[model samples]
Target: MNLFRHAAFEISVASPDGLPFSPAPEVAFAGRSNAGKSSAINTLAGHTRLAYVSKTPGRTQLINLFRLKNGAALVDLPGYGYAEVPAAVRRQWQGLLEHYLTRRENLVGLVLIMDARRPFTDLDRKMVAWFGTTGKPIHCLLTKADKLTNQEQIKVLRDAKAEAASLVGNITLQLFSSLKKKGIEEVEKIVGGWLNPEIRGEAS
Candidate 1:
């Protein structure tokens, strides 16, 4: 789709004031630290470094927003589950994330990135419930798919789907790998629909 041809970084929100208020539809990318969330963003945008908030893990402690050429917003939220970060700082991020998730008026959906090999943990399940309560469409991306064998991949995908189905409706799951640029188009297509629901459709 030549997504990069139309993609441009818009802004970075260190605090709530920096949050986008344009009322344009937005899809947020969220995951644990070292979970390949940043890599997935770069892949979807067709840019190798566009979403490189940091090469070192646990550094992107802000809500970074990128604007596509179509005027849709791609929000890169800071990674949770970083143990080295201070408890107070992590707590602050939790508060900030909760505020954004619960209060953002233009938020269209969430792209929950998870490590394919690891699958769901306690934190992921909780986050699923939290985002579900906000009534936002969520598409779970199982990142680093190349790390698993074909059979294992298929099993994990099925299990993840079943787990997610138990928690929320209107959810989509995709097998992804940023290294090989896998599932990039699928992610873009999903986000594209979020910004244009009339064209995307109302059903799975």
Candidate 2:
């Protein structure tokens, strides 16, 4: 079986204080609302519901952790930029996410999922800036690529790559489609590399 085929939900925490301290290296998935972050994880895990899928943009408001058989973990962070959610709730997530991203010691990489048609927005840029301070490797999956024509997908990939260098120091970009299962191998390899100490150097 592939390394991530058994990925299963371990826990969910609304605040940093509740975070479980694990010695295993962890890589997190984060993005704006409706960016296909959960779907990407489910696709990689070869499961239908590894991460909860919601039609509502802001329904996921917790930091969810998924554990692998190898003792490594994949974290799913709450999506940002959901204007309908209460301002107080959004502010709480801001603090919780910041603390986790900035201070978590086991974090080795961050997977930033983005919609191919709308790669980055004002909030997305803000997230890039915030994650930049961690100095960790970031891998961007331009999800929903199947929705675009080949030419359009290529153009978005080119543009996102061009902007990423200026935004994040250590970053990689690839096109993805959770529906069509596109780029699953690349995503798995990149994420797997991060969890494997022998090849983690290459991932970084």
Among these predicted structures, which one has the highest lDDT?
Answer: 2
In candidate 2, where is summed lDDT lowest over 10 consecutive residues? Answer: 195-204
Q: Please write out the lDDT profile of model 2 over residues 1-204, one tens digit for every residue.
A: 376789888899988678788888988889989999999989999999889999999888889999988888888999988899899988988877788888888899889989998987888887778888778878999999999999999899999999897885578999999999999889888777777797766645
Q: How close is candidate 1 to the true structure, as a TM-score?
A: 0.91
- For model 2, the stretches where C-alpha displacement exceeds 4 angstroms are 200-204
Score every model by TM-score.
0.91, 0.95
Candidate 1 ranges with C-alpha deviation above 4 Å: 2-5, 53-55, 197-204
Q: What C-alpha lDDT, on a 0 to 100 scale, does residue 111 get in candidate 1?
A: 89
For each predicted model, how many residue pairs clash, with residues at least 3 apart or on different chains?
1, 0
What lDDT score is found at residue 56 in candidate 1?
A: 72
